[model samples]
Target: MKPVENAEGIQASLTLSYIQATVLKAKATLTVGILNGAPINIGIVGQADVVSDGKEGSAGLVHTDLLMQYDIQNDQFDAFLKATVKVIIAEAKVPIWLYFGANTPIPIGETAAEQKTRQSQNSNFDYYLYVGCPDGNGASRLGDAFSKVKVTIWKMDAGIVSGSLYGEAYFCIGSILPKFPPLPDEINKFLGYSTQSSNENSVINMINQGGSASGFMFGALVHGNINVDLAVIRAYAKATVGFDVALLHVTNPGSCQVGTSFGMNNWYAVGQVFAYFAMGVDLHIDVGLFSGNVTLAKLQVGAAIKAGLPNPTWMNGRIKIVGEALGGMVHVNKSMKFEIGEVCVPEMDPLASIKLIAEVGPGTDNVSVFAKPYVIFNLPMDNKPFKFNVMDKEGHETTRTFRFKVDHYTVKSEDNGYVGQGTKQFSADGYTMTLWSDEAFREKMKYTITIHCKAEELINNNWQKPAGKSEEEESIAFTTGIAPDTISERHVVISYPINGQNYFLKNEFKGKKSMVVVDQRNDKYFKLENDSNPIKKLTIIEADGGQVINTNFSVNGNDILFDLPGSLKNSTTYRMYFSIESSKTQEIKTTTELVDLEKTAGTGTVSMADVDFSTVSINTSVNILGASGSGNAIQSPTTTSASERGIRNKAKQEQSHRDAIDRFRKGETPVMTVINEGIENGTVDPTKIQDGTTAQGKEVAVYQPATGRIIYQMILEPVNLTPSPIKWLPLEVS
Candidate 1:
């Protein structure tokens, strides 16, 4: 052994020699102080052997020792340095005391030379090895000294220990011994291994002192591929005025080689050191720390699925068009090539792609344990009701089965029904799917939808099951939202003239018939009908103060037909009213506007207007029959004188004309017939029957009004009418 002094203090080095094949274990204890003064005994163990480093053939002897330093007060060892070594070799089965440095502490203020020579005279102990090892003589015995001792002692096992002790030592000043091994907390202060450095004042201070405290794992002591920055260790060593003591005080399991056994064996020591030193932390051998598929952090899969529209929708029929959204959390294990390998969560067939929502931490190339993934699918339509069943890889039913039904209606018949009563299996290959419904859908009156899901079905992009309970659940049901008070459409009067004359009231059916001139458009009367029909009690009213006229009426293919009343003034405007009763009552009415006579030649196609025409008397006469004509006046007496005969003849002619006009006022088509007969027989004067033309293809009469106009009214029943053209059907998008 040789002792040397440096800027900090003095340190010494020594070696313990043993027969390689015979030695099983070894330990050493040293007691040193100033000669002839109090001595301090400090215990330490030898953990490494040079014999393991291919040095076993040095004259059949192997040397072993540990490189270590102890901080001793300079005043404690003044001049004559005294030390002794008691070694126990497993093969020897005995203890040998090897005297080295002089014993006892020098009195304060004594020089090294003075103390050394003074102690040499009084102390009998010398730097020599004693023979004949004692049996448990303790550390106090000096044994027998000889000029040269060739003692062979048996070695002993250090024995496996449950806990470990670790610490550092400074070179001189025995009282300034290295602090008890820094637990992980204190280590974190220098290494910043347990948490973020930005928040740790100790770590920040370390960095500010021109050193980084990152890249260290405080969970365990590691060698070889150690997770530590050599530069940081150097910086810490400089600041603490001492080197780090990574040594583990554990039993040395034999066969440890510096070149080949650095990893596993050293790791064993590291684990024990942590298990013993890290307060309150339960430590164990973590196999994952050395695996290729280690999980740096976990963005666990969830057993819950969330919907974009979690609430019931008013547009249930349009759900397919609206699309549904679903998703969960996922982690990209960077160590496994940015994939969550099968060892953790395996990828399944259904997931299409993944989007890294965000990085779980600051490093982009590191594990993204907090990322998110989403799935969106637009529903498809079919001719039958929809049913979706969810299952697992084992073919067992996992999630509940979803169901949907679509009800439809036809405009003409107002018939309503639903399609599909059977079940259909769903596929798990994708997030998108086809939803069954009636392709005949035009307008949906009502509908409902059910969604199914199992705790296991709600997996991550990797199809990994969540770390939660795999509970099975029933379907979630959602129905259509509240319907509006009334249904409406764009319907204009499909009859004659112009829209100026076809302006109907909103929310109802009503309008004027003036511009609808006789024998003009549609051959005679103004008419109106809509998508909703089989309308009843269709009647016309003179809004400008005129009674309902008696007119011919009929219905032909959704059209309400009637005669242009002769009594209706040419410029006068009128309103019409009607109703439809089918589960609900719909009263239709018309609005009055001046007849655009100039536009009477144009086809009327205007935005339909309607008003809620209140319920009117349903018992009103549907048709008003014209009254019979008065009988012809009697002829004057034939026996009268010439003056009396002329008077009688004129009186009879006047009475005959009046009877014909009376019939015409009653809207009787026979009135014109009687007039023509009078003219042919010379009983009615030619000039009395002013010229008037009847509608070319009509059997009705158009007689000249010498004085007053006639009133005409009639009603058409739809029971005998032809089928309507408008057909209402339910429709679904996509």
Candidate 2:
């Protein structure tokens, strides 16, 4: 039959005899046509090894072998293949069309219309059209022919357009075709093409050689094509610039295998790339335009470009003392020093030498000294020590004992006394002193020190006794002096006199003293006497009889009942003494000695009776004549003498009364006695006077009263006088 024409100038035709012989591989059996085009042949290949027999001469055909053979499959493969084939055919130069008819027997020359009618009456008939092509090329040609055909076919029948061919023809074709090998040079280019390329094997091999070289080459190639489809060289240059700008250019690059697929494997490599170059390159390539599906080669190229950039380092230097002086007192007399060992700088070049300038004081007079500040070149290096000079304010260079040493790059300055004596002396009463060494030595050695003053002499050679006295006496004149001593050297001596003997006093008072006295007195007290008053009072006095009598004194009382005298006669030396004496009594008359009367009890005692008087009254008259001759014989009592005697008698009587009252108050009995011509007598009354009553309107002495109550009283008078009315009477009851 003649082929039909489609809009694209493609044709479609079918023969029943060709369908049976080619698809079924059977001898000519039946021929019939139910439509204007050939029927499609859908075959399922269940195994990868299955080969399609070209005898299936159907114009519209699809195979499902590839999908069925794979352990895992997805609809993507199916869809991709279907769309590819449909597009290829739709774009061809010829138009082709086919159809199926009922399974009715007909001769090979039968027309399409006649076949269709014959198959209409038989519902059980299944028909297929043979387009006379077994190979893909021939089938493709047939499809090209249909492209020009103009039959009104339903859009639903366009299986290729809808992607249903993915499960049938596309997958089947993939299963039959041989997989391409990888190529290193054209990997990225090959992947760029829509159709599979010949260099696949070479590309995969390059990916497997994961390293800087492969990463750079592959990544550059891939990155360029995807980037803007720019030239590979241009893309590489752009990426490198970006890496530099970003400061991410890696000095070293590395690569690794990330993953693999059915026909393609993925590789991953990373390295720092310059942000500037990468950015520029990416912009040129319009990388953002691409979807997320980028090849590993592109990423590796970007990373490698980043690896070739450089970063700069910053550094500075400085110096300072690590440790301070122990006491913080820098003295000139001792070794004043510090260490250069603590000097340090950061980010310094290991191979470079450090330069340090050390100044001790004013630049004008001071000297600058230093040793080569170079560290040793060793595998593991240490700080280097260099000795520098220390200058004084006056610019004088002082001597030092210790020095600094650097060995094996290890720097250290030891405590060398050479900087100075390391010892200082200060007058006990002087100001703080300072001493230091030359600046040169100081820079080399470091030291901390405690300052101390030398002890002053407690007794210097100039100490001497005052002159004029014997050595023994003069020795007492020596005194103590102040001095500071090293804790180990404290000692002192004191000299003074004791009694007549001279003694050297030793370290007695170590600290400050108010005064020192030396006394030679045997006794501390003495008696004072008037040569003319042998019977007078004696007095006690303090002795002023020593060379050391610098102290003062005074008398405690004027009355001298007894005397205690201090040593007298300073040069001769007399001892202290004491004296005692008594006063004389008056004469008494004879007959008044014996008398018995009621006695009164004293103030302090209890009384039993009223008046069994022991009160005495005795009168005795005697004539007073001049020693030469009696100037006048006494006749009657003259008022003059009488008055005198009365006064005297009154005084006497009052005294006696007071005495008696005192005795009674003290709980003692009052006694009345009269002694005459060498005879002493008194009267005692056992049961007598009453307790005394205090007299009113009578003057009584207001002396400090004794403890207890008054109990008795007594009265005495001369026999010649009349008794006055009793001003005070005693109670009679016991």
User: Evaluated with TM-score, which candidate comes out highest?
Assistant: 1
User: Model 1 has how many clashing residue pairs?
Assistant: 57
Task: Report RMSD for candidate 1.
Answer: 43.6
- lDDT of every predicted structure (CA atoms): 0.25, 0.21
What is candidate 2's lDDT per residue for 543-633, written digit by digit as tens? 2333211111222221111111222222122111122111221111111111221112222111111111111111112221221212232
lDDT for 514 (candidate 1): 19
Instruction: List, residue by residue over 1-734, the lDDT tens digit for candidate 1.
Output: 11211112222334454565244224444434321132222324343333243343321123433222221322111111112223433121112233334333223334779756754642411233322211112232222221211222232223321222222212111111111223334333322233321111221111112111111111212211112122212100101111222122111212222334422333221111221111111122236545222222212111111111101100100000011111113323211111111111111121111110100111111111111111122222122222233223332323332212112211110133442322332335333222322121122222222233222223332333434322221111111212112112222223332222311112111222211111111211122333233222333455544655423334443343443433433323455432222223332324223121111111232212221111111222222122331223233233453334334433543443454355455554433322333322113332332222232211123232342222111111222212322111111111
TM per model? Answer: 0.17, 0.11
* Clash count per candidate: 57, 119
